[model samples]
Target: MLHHWYISHHHLYIPPSMTIHHHHHLLLLLILFLLTPPLSTSQNDTVSCPLNFDLLRRLVGSNRPSIDSSTVCRYAQQALRLVESDHLRRTSSFVPPPNTAESCWTAYQAVSDYFYPNFDLRRNCGFQTNWITVPGCMNITNRQQFENKISNSSLNAVVSACNQSLTGSSCSSCTVALSNLQASYLNGESVGNLTDCRAYPFIYAAAFINQLGPTDRGTAVCLFSLSINFSKSNNKHKTVIIVIVITVVIVIVLFGSAIGFWYSKRLKKLNRKRRKKAEINTVSALDSYTGSTTLIRYTIEDIKEATRNFSRDNIIGRGGYGNVYRGVLPDDTEVALKRFKNCSAAGDGSFAHEVEVIASVRHVNLVALRGYCTATTPFEGYQRIIVTDLVKNGSLHDHLFGSESLRANLSWPVRRKIALGMARGLAYLHYGVQPGIIHRDIKASNILIDENFEAKVADFGLAKFAPEGATHVSTRVAGTMGYVAPEYALYGQLTERSDVYSFGVVLLELLSGKKALLSLGDGQPVLLADWAWSMVRNNTPLEVIDGGMAECGPPEIMEKYVLVAVLSSHPQLYARPTMDQVLKMLDMDFPVPTIPERPMPLVAGIEDIERSVSSTGSAQLSTPRGYQAYTFEMDVRLASKEEEEGKC
Candidate 1:
């Protein structure tokens, strides 16, 4: 016919004009046929979860029988991992789709093959594909809710408790807590078929391990295996267990005794070496100073008898350095024995060498060293001991601002005398010695009061001696907060002036009956120096004196003492007077100078503080450095630029 065209299985016919276009279409079809993948390969690539044959083999152990319902969950977990890891493992160049899934048949087949010979694990053990992410009891509404609930539970704490210790026992509290967590939140009670309920613990462990550490995974997996404990009750086995236990105990006793004996001998040898080293350092340091006081070496037994085995009742005072205990010496002398808490070998050397510092100095106003003892005991380690005459009154801090019963003992005259005595003691350390000793920790607590209420400067653990002709020794800053001088606190440039600055703070404390560091209304710390100076600069000097002592002394005398304290604690290092100069100021041998108007402290971190200061005019923040209190000052930098310029 009419220009006949035919399309058949083997042949196609077209009119001569359209024959060229037909050939092009046939060529395009041939290219696609060559590029297309085989059916099997495409099927393999499409399966979201591919269970490696080797991984399945490892999951079902060779040692065990084909699993029960509880055991089959372990196999289910291995199959579930492929899905979870895919979520983390990328499929394309970098970014991937947020979620992925697979045919339930894929998971079912691999998990079935895991127990290879017995492939019908579901019928035998009642396992299912949906049990992958959570236990059967927790009926989750959505994917997000499931994730949120598990995350909120934070099973780490409970799981950590169940971690087996060296003794091969786990925390009972852990078991109880975990049980409660399951009951309350996880709905751990069997609510479904018995087979699914049996599968819950294993699935629960699998979900929890994904969130926990690797070390905890082993413990978590065994939770159910260990929990399935069966108690065998038989009279015959009870006798056998008791006999086995006795034999094991006997063997362990013999082995342990040998180890303990060897350890004790080794410890004794090490302690002897430390004791000898400490002695040499003590002798060498003491020999250099040719003072009249002798460091009498006492025995450890004598010390123990003196302090009644270091009884708690005998504890007279305690500080950051050590505890001071009251003891009666064999010679019928009452002594205060300072037992340092530092039992380390390095600490032994320090306290040993320092025994000569305050011990060698003989002054009525200074706590003289009666004697010192260094001994080693099997139990108490190396004992570095120092003996001194006991001061009946605890400390200047005790009477002036200590407990109420102690505070009553201090009248205005007594406070004045104590202040004078403290100045004398510090003066002796600074000027009386050939090489001046800087009492770096010169605070009210360090100044002990005797029966006569005389203040004796004590606790020379942080003392440093000025080298000949050196103005300031650049050393580590060691002192209390609210008392450290500007140069020493910021730059660690220490000198005799650092001690004077501390003394000034103590003097201020004595006058105001306020602590050197005062906590304000909002728990902000205001230094006594700042508060006292503010009153004196405002012509209300009497306000700085203790309200109780307001009428005890002439207002003029009190005002003079207040002015001297302010002068001695001046922020600038050079502006601070030496201890000798301070002594004369207290004695009125030198007149009180004109009061200086203190500007905002131009010390370290003041700029950051100025920037951080809010509308409230005070801010609590960390210190750039550390001292006693652990926090820096806000009152120190409260004044603004305009105010500082106006006051200065």
Candidate 2:
């Protein structure tokens, strides 16, 4: 009779066997029987064993007839007991086959040895280890691909690469890999933990387990469920489904939160922009516009041609509107063109207002306004064309101490005359006109001098229309950096005294022959007024005079000029001497001391300069002195007197 081996939920059964003596076959049967329970609990239905019959027939067919059925059956029973002893679950009762157990055991052993012992496998078996490992694990779904890579890499090297130590507390890389592993599984992506062998071993393991191949029996059971009760095996399907659903919910919540945060920030930015726009609009609406005489328009092309295409070479000076360019008209008359900035909307309005106010008011000491180009073009947005009479000697800054030659010629008498001319121009703006205009941005740069070295106050872009009803104009404050008064800069108050304060700074610059602000060796900023005030308070006022200036005049004259400048430049506006007070100072007399040449430190070629001027312009240097003047080297003279006068 043929023998058989049977496996069921209740037990493993070995049938009585025919005699066969094959050592390898006997060992195979023993191993298989050992892997299953000898006794079976009555959990399900039983079946007859076929292993006894198959083993007997194969042995006889191979001409091996020495094996005994009783011996095989006994070996199978012992192996089954050993396997059952290792299992954590209890054994159950089952029916035994009639054939010898040896035959069934041999058959079972052959199949078990074929698949199990050839590869390394690890079972967690209720341990705390991160993952379970399996070896020689053939895939039922993708067997060929897995086997190909297995031969390509050494077993230990592949294992070692995956089992690398994490080593550090910073686990951001590990966390990202874990997230990607989970996301890929949820997305139905092909993931194999061991196959990919990512840097993180555990993440790779998770993917591997997820994609593992089912056994042959598993495939049959799984396929049958498709036709039968597919939803019955919750363990086989529901775990992955739950993970996918949770992942989707998390992604949706995160996306919604990100969008909400972005919208909130965008709303705040929009609100801030709206508030700023409203503030600017209110200021523009409240701006007084009654003083404007007429509105004019000009193309950018026309203005460019007038000012040599806005060339740097043509820039005589700069103002709030833009650069003042020296240009000549088609009528052969010279014109001072004030080109307003293309980007400045507020400046455009002020430029128009200046043209109206300056064009109507005529004064000899103030720079004369002739014509304007209110240039408007589709390409340029807006442009201002201001035509004024050109002064030949550039600004007062240039003539005072600008060139080696000019400083030599800037004798005491000439400086006094320039001071008086500046006073007269300021007085006219302060009290001489219809509605006294304050030249808000008063500085050496704004004061133009003719070839004869007369001061002409210019740049009234910051000028305010002070009429009967207005006590103060609530407007944006504007002035040059060092010339700005502290109160005006802080409060945006427009008044005539603000102009006086800036003029005082200009006066201090004149007295010291230094720029209003200077950076010293230790990076300290020294304003000219503060430095001069220090000298004045120390009673060493002559120390503040320019080297070239010190030698050109007597100590007594220099002292008087220093006192006037210091009084004008006092920090408090009320403490400052007015232009009228300044004029009186120029006319006042003190006992003339034996005016000795004051000593001074050497500036660049100042010693040579003083030696030269003392010899040549000695006669011209003998007059009484006034406020000191800062100087520059750049000559801003227009070529001809007729051209200059015609432009004004």
Give the winner by lDDT.
1
Q: What is the lDDT for 41 in model 2?
A: 65
Global Cα lDDT for candidate 2: 0.49
Q: What is the C-alpha local distance difference test score of candidate 1?
A: 0.60
Residue 412's lDDT within candidate 2 is: 66
Residues 1-648, model 1: lDDT tens digits:
354565444445666765677668866765665566545555556435432334333433342222334334444443334323232222211111212123443555664664445556455556543333232344432334434555445466555554343011232234334544553455445433221322332234333433432113233223322111112347588789889999999999999998998899999999879857766665565545434556677889899999999999999987555678999988799999988665555565457546757765779999888777766678877677788888897888787776777877777788889989998998999999978899888888888988888899988877887798975687755666677775566456787888888898999999889998887686866678877877886889889888875337877777888888898887545356678887888886688755433423111233233334442111111121222233253223322311221110
Badly placed stretches (over 4 Å) of model 2 are: 1-305, 308-312, 318-320, 343-347, 399-403, 467-475, 519-521, 588-648
Give residue 583's error in model 1 in angstroms: 1.7
Expressed as tens digits, the lDDT of each residue in 1-648 for candidate 2 is 445655555454555453455445755776776777666465453333332223222211322212122123222222222222111012111112323233333444553333233221212112111111111122212323433444333323333322332211112123233334433332222232221222122222222321221111121111111000111335447689879989999999999997998799898878767645644553343233322433234455656777778889988876433577888766777777876564333344455567656865667789887656543357765455666788978886775548877666666666766777877888777678778787777878888878888888987766777665554454554566567554354345565666766776776666667877765576755557767776776789898777776345677777887777766665434345556667677666733212111211111122223333433211111111101111110011111321222221
Alpha carbon RMSD to native, model 2: 37.3
